[model samples]
Target: MKEEDIRELELRAILEASNDNIVIADGKGKVLRVSPNCYSIYGMKTEELVGKTADELEKMDVWSPSVTKRVLQDKKEVQVMQHTLTGRSVMATALPVFDEQGEMIRVISFSHDLTELRQIKEDYEELRAKMEYYQSEIQELRDKDQHMDGIVLKSKELSNVWQLIHRVAPSDATVVFLGESGVGKNVFARAIHDKSNRSKEAFIEVNCGAIPETLFESEMFGYEKGAFTGANKEGKPGLIELANKGTLFLDEVGELPLNLQAKLLKVIQEKKVTRIGGTQTKQIDFRIIASTNRDLQEMVREGKFREDLFYRLNVVPITILPLRERKDDLLQLCEFFLDMFNEKYKTDKVLHAATINEMLDYSWPGNVRELENLMERLVITTENRVIYPSALPFHTKESQSEVFELETEELPEQADNLQEALRDVEIRWLKRAYRQYKTTYEMADYLGISQSSVVRKLQKYGINS
Candidate 1:
């Protein structure tokens, strides 16, 4: 065979074996040759396309916007995306071959199928959109968690209270929170205020009980300059006036004197406030949230609280359950407080399981406030990193007595001598008493011994309070 014929055969074999569709076109845009793979991309055999021009093939809907035609017109390399009649996507590139005279001689085009690539890209875009949407939803949940302000809604009672808060937060109706002294009434008041439309404005808090009866009027209602001897010279805005376009949190409203109850009611009814000694009335737009630990109805019956004022403030009443009733939240609350104070005080304290069990048994009379304080105290004062039951201030005698019984039950097996066993029993009881009582006087009273004897015994036993 001739050398030129062998090279021609090799070139044809290379073109037929290529994964891409190869096409050769004349400078005038006439197709001269096509690779065997042309059928897969353009859905046409090589022989059917060999004699056709790019314009004719485009007109036949084989592939739109031909790169070969673009290369012929521009006399340079060109690339384009083409859609085939066979429902395939392809990326085609064409380059012109020039002679020594710098005139274009031929255009060689190569096309790669892009149908699967396009589908994969589309799938990636869809997944990215979904991931972004989920991230935004998670961020929204985190924002809501920040607004919770350490409140644990594990119990059904608190969950119901939260539902009520959600139902009433959007409105401007007066909300009164009723609960025991440490049941987090103020915390609920703040939650509602934060969820309301006026969250961006000032939240003026007034402890009606903390303010004296003599100065309650002046403090609640602002006074003009020189209105009284001790009044601010530039005049002062009272709690009510300061709460304009915001929330007025009247904490312990039941302590308000009878004279001021009518006045507060008038302000709530009219949404206006006047200075203590001034006649000019200022129009106020504010939301009222009152919290109290007292029974206002009983006070009204006893002629202490005005019925009309009580009725006015009781538009939306929300009751918060004490901590003891919400026992499910105890462990979560303990962990929350531990994390908070540990971060605050730079400690790594953890609650022992026994301590948690003891906490579950105790009745928290002081409610969440007491628990919070106790956690803080334990975190600061505990010598070890783990907080145990012996570190807690409040423990029932029944629980401590169980420890005594367990210790005595093992005395016979553990003790060697009778005197040593009796001494061991005394030491254990004294230590138990020390753990149960805060002072030696209380321990002495419980043991029916003198205070001096209790101190001496505790000293001998090396027990420290």
Candidate 2:
């Protein structure tokens, strides 16, 4: 075959194989051929859209790329962004088709729908911001009162965590955040979305445990204007609808009622929802990130949670260590809370050494939220920053627990068996702390040492980490 005939066949093959919605426009901008993908990309049928002029397409918000116009004039490829008749956002790249004579005989363009990609990107960016700010804050938290997860530790465990987060921050995978209550799962969820591709979209949070069973469907799926007597006149959109093209976080998801579990499963599976009293199904493009304190697998066996959902959400599981595991960070939280309260109350005060010592001894059962409340209260109740043990709510408890501390107490210089006495003191302190706070990291803070140091000391004396 002649070189010219071979080039024509090559051009035909290129047009046929393109996955993008493609169209050809002669120099005068008349429609020549539209690719097969064009119908699917526009959510329309082909026969209904052939032989339309560029002006006719403009009525449906379709037009050649600005660059395409330049391409036609300059005989080059041009890219365009426009909305299709079906409302899908599209991007088009128009390449001028030439004959053997090198004259522009036609323009071939490829287009793609960017709705899902763009929405996910928006959600991702929003989640990334959350993760970035909080991840950075962990290193800077003040001592005494702070969220455990918000506190950064100089440990391989935490180093691994940061690395893992960075690895997983870019996708829309359903994440199952595993952590104890008050370990900041919700915060991490927000961070994931903020750091993700869906950052520009809305981030909706749903606490499954908080929504009652009878109203779960209506609350989550929404209802029409007259669906019920109390329904909004304009018909309320469900959380799913509100979160369209964004992120929907299910907090305490293990607590979701069983009757509604199937509904959630459908949404995750089909990516479509039918609001209450509404017949039409609306397709959604959103990412799911769920957090839970309860053991979902155990619940599945107990018939309280679904195993399928668990498997689906576990695509990416991030487990956060409890506050007790990161003892190196306790003082940082204390100072963070102290400064926060100081600024809020406009007080120029400092922590009393004795008061801090007492605080370290008491266990924080309620986690970060508990610590924050304590600091705020202490700051408000106390007259000065020179906080005395008496100013704290747990002072009496600490005094009572002083007996436990004596067992592991650091020996006095007056004692010849100093090391043994100090060992006893440490044991007593650890016991008292375990009884008060559920976390060992909290105990380590009370002793004012790295948690591993505590573990090592205890191990030397036959203690558990």
Candidate 3:
């Protein structure tokens, strides 16, 4: 072969082997030649691109702000970031090749694909933003948990209750809390008092059921010195008087005798109390917060409770739902009490997954108090660091058996093959976990699987997480 022909073939081989897209254009920006990989970068065949001008290709949206055009116009090297019709991002640079007479001869451009790098940068930024958002949410939840006064307010029902409490706490509207025993009525009553303007003053809790009938009058309304035997030498203030400028929580108000109920009603209505065997009536200023588990309306209809007194105390009634109905808070409550007792007793006990599932299934009849008590018992009695299903009390599993039966009864009809039956069970569990937990991390923890596996299985089954 001739030496010139050999040199031309070598240059062609170099252009073909180059990784970047290389294009050579004339001084007027007319395309002269393009490397084979130019098609991949611009989404056009080499033959279609060879005869096209830079301005024509730019109009076709092959690549915007052509580096070749810039190099040709400026007669110098130019670099630009270009977006191509192929949906590829590129960093393109063009250098003008000048003849010996200082006249432009050609423009040689090189383009490096940046699509994958740009995508990676975007994904990193999105993940960073999500992390910040999740961290803020977690911190907010921790703050709420610390200040809730041993109350787990995770459920929507409890959130509404908190809203109602805030609305009524600012006013002294004679609030009353109605719920089953151990539903944290006393805690809520104290919460109301603390949220009020009189929070700086005394909060006297009077259990009407615990006071004896004979002593109820003196206990509620103080006795003067020497009024009766065993009376204090100095005049004593009554419970109502002691609560002046503060809150008086009357726990189990329904247990008060009908005669005493009349007196209590007078004290609430008049905001004044007269000491026993005393002639002068004393003025009082206080807020009344009452709670009762019994049906005072039924008592009034049965002639056991005074009707007028019932109306006076039933002004702003707040009913707290039982723990069974607010299952969303059960896991948090359990973990809270467990951590509390663990610190109190200096133990390190963790609940196993099975034990947690069993606890979730059981219906807590005794409410939060029962759950607290059970956690304390388990923390104290469980021998190992991890408390498993066998550590659960017999009554808990017995109660859960009915729920388990109901859940199992609704299972899909028996499949002809074992594989189908197993798949049906898997789908049922996935749906149940999805409904019970708020996040995939929680679902994975409850279902005893990796988070990635949970996501993949959910996608495979067409389950929307």
TM-scores of the candidates are 0.58, 0.54, 0.65
| lDDT score for residue 272 of model 2 | 90
- Give lDDT: candidate 1, residue 392: 84
In model 2, which runs have C-alpha deviations exceeding 4 angstroms? 1-156, 397-465
Could you tell me how far off, in angstroms, the CA of residue 234 lies in candidate 1 after the best superposition? Answer: 2.0
- The 0-to-1 C-alpha lDDT of every candidate, in the order given, reads 0.87, 0.73, 0.87
Question: How does candidate 2 score on lDDT?
Answer: 0.73
Evaluate model 1: give its lDDT. 0.87
Q: Count the backbone clashes (under 3 Å) in each candidate.
A: 0, 47, 0
Candidate 2 residue-wise lDDT, 43-70, digit = tens = 5555554666565666555543333455
Error of 1 at 209 (Å): 0.4
Candidate 1, which ten residues in sequence have the lowest lDDT sum?
400-409
| Candidate 3 lDDT by residue in tens digits, 1-465 | 999999989878978999999999998889988899888889998899998899999999999989998887787899999999898999999999889998898999999999999999999999999999999999888657544788777788887888888899989899989998888999999998988899999999999999999999899899999989999989788999899999999999999888888888989999888899899988899999999999988999999999998889899999998888888788879888998999999999998665777787788888899999999999999888988666667445554453233233454676878788888888877876776678899989978999999999899898883
Q: Which candidate ranks first by TM-score, i.e. highest? A: 3
